[model samples]
Target: MNDLHQKELLLKSILENTRAQTQAIEDDELELLETLITRREGIIRQVDKLDQEMARTTPGTSKEPTGPIKELLRQIITIDDANQELMEKSVQDMGKEVEAVKEELRTIRERRRQGESYVPEYGDYREEGVFFDTRE
Candidate 1:
């Protein structure tokens, strides 16, 4: 296969894998998601290099790719968009959870402060003197 075709295939594969990884976010598989994100970043770098190579090889007038390559490019764009949305939603959800935790902490602190100031109705008593007897 030609280099362009190979690059297209690789890009499509990476995009597909990234889409799959985004699904893992819903499952709460954080470790796997982190690994996948790292892999996706590496693949994105590869895609960028390939894009640069294609740009260098192609004529300036023919700015757009044609045929199967074009179609694959469109698919990659759609998948990437979906993955971006998913990631954004995940971040928003995490932000909400963090806010909830902060509010809960604030409530706990307020209650602790209130408790500290509270005093029972009964008065406190103190011993004023101590005596020791040596007779047996």
Candidate 2:
């Protein structure tokens, strides 16, 4: 009876540990997502600034003349477009990571549901004891 109690306690401890680790990983992932969103927002603001600058510097075919500001504006626009594309790809990758994590969580839940019995779920382990190759 004591052995059974100890086994149960051990399983409970393992489950608790797993839950804690999962929670920590989830928190970290959330923080990373927030950071990504913040970065995207910053990029958007930069794009808006570029737009305003361009509008001020090149409203029409001004009789005066375009300066280095026009060239700089063009370069800024290119940079903004590239940054936007890169951020979009990063977001897509993050989404894939989220899905992978979710799948891992699902698998962990299933394994937990199966219980921590020493008996193997396949092969001749049900009757042949440890001599059986459970992997088969």
Candidate 3:
């Protein structure tokens, strides 16, 4: 197989994995997402290895990507951008939740502090104990 064709196949595989990753993200399938990302990484490593071999064989030659490869890369980059945006939104939502929890805790502490500030009437304890008998 031609090296370019091999690279194309690898890139297509990466792109397919990337699409699956997007679906995993949307569905909140964390385990599947992790697996997809790992697979993509392995595919990417293969692509890099292929490129290195090609470079070694064709020294000093500019190996600009052909049209279809360029298009695949473009799509991959665009989807990756969307994925980044989704993750950022998730982070922001979680941040808001954390702040709300902190606020609730602060309110509870303040209410508790106020409730603790009251002193019981001194007369209340007097009934529980007998004064020295004034009358025989």
Candidate 4:
């Protein structure tokens, strides 16, 4: 296929992958998210190769890529930006959750230690004495 067609296809593929990546993150599908990211990287590489080939073939041409290619690129960037925002929020939220869990664990451990303090070191409880008062 021609370079333009190839680039278009690659861009479209990236767009599709980006959308899927967003979905994967939202769904909490780690494996699928990784796969989508890898696929998108490969598509990006292909696009880069096409750009290099084109530049070599047309040394003095300074015209920018236009039409559907431009539009595709714009859409890709917008979606990617949103995806990045989502990922940042996810990471932040995850950190908060981890902190909360850690705090809970600390609280539990502290309570356990405090509770243990109430017990005898020998692990046995004996009455020191019994006191009874009877009045008639």
Candidate 5:
């Protein structure tokens, strides 16, 4: 088989394995992202090989690849781009969640500034010592 065909086959196989990995994700989204990146790297390697063979075999044949191979490569590029955007958004969302929790804690502290307080499990909160007289 020609190098171009071989590279295409390898890329297809990698894509299939990647899809399987993605489908296996239940709760850990990072696993899917990691597998996507790995698949992208494999696609890049395969495309590089295909490009080299095409250049060596048929010099000055159209720079743009045609047919199914071209479509598959385009899809791979799009997926990688999308994955990067999603990863960035996920991090930003997590930062926002943390900030929201901090805001809530700050509000609670401000409201309870004058009452008997207990130290937080995760941090220090000043305790107000007010002795109660129980003699009637």
Candidate 6:
């Protein structure tokens, strides 16, 4: 029972941290995002271990979670969903930006190719006659 409560508090803290990390993702802070993701993964591992322990302790019947636990779970779910949406949007925006850059590079390359093949308007030079051979 006490262990369960402690685990619940830990879970809540992890959820809050995860939520903050998700917000960091939206801000485009990739370094902080990476650190936060690693921390969240560790917390997830802890949560999984606690869940397994709880399952082992209760074998006959499943116990209903407390009201606060339920609420916390709901909040975590909502935040995770929003985070997923933001991540998807960010990926799409990056893809579009990459394509635009590629197109610009192609255009620049084409212009350079054209410039290399350009011919100036000066007339061609040629020798037509020789005048000094008669004196020899």
Task: Choose the strongest candidate by lDDT.
Answer: 4
| 21-103: candidate 4 lDDT, tens digit per residue | 89988887889999999888888888888898999998886658799999999999999999999899899999999999999
Each candidate: what lDDT? 0.79, 0.53, 0.87, 0.90, 0.68, 0.82
Tens digits of per-residue lDDT for model 3 on 40-80? 99999999999999999888866888789899999999998
Quote the lDDT for 34 in model 2. Answer: 53
Once model 3 is optimally superposed onto the true structure by TM-score, how far is the C-alpha of residue 84 displaced, in angstroms? Answer: 1.4
lDDT of 1 by residue, 1-136 (tens): 6767777777777767777776787687889888887887888788778778777887573657788778877877787787778879888999999999999999999998898678553656655887889899
Off by over 4 Å in 4: 125-136
The lDDT, on a scale of 0 to 1, for candidate 2 is 0.53
Give the 10-residue window scoring lowest on summed lDDT in candidate 3: 119-128
lDDT (tens digit, per residue) of candidate 6 on 42-104: 887887788788788777645666677778888888888888889899999999999999999
Structural similarity to truth (TM-score) of each candidate: 0.67, 0.41, 0.74, 0.86, 0.57, 0.78
Kindly give the stretch of ten consecutive residues in candidate 4 with the minimal lDDT sum: 58-67
lDDT of 4: 0.90
Error of 6 at 89 (Å): 0.3
**Which has the higher lDDT value, candidate number 3 or candidate number 4?**
4
Candidate 5: stretches off by over 4 Å: 13-28, 111-113, 116-136
Model 1 clash count equals 0
For model 2, residues 1-136, the per-residue Cα lDDT tens digits are: 3322433343334334334433434455556545544554554565456455556766773433145444444554565455456556667888999999999999998898777555566845445446756794
Between candidates 3 and 4, the one scoring higher on TM-score is 4
Query: Model 4, residue 134: what's the lDDT?
Result: 88
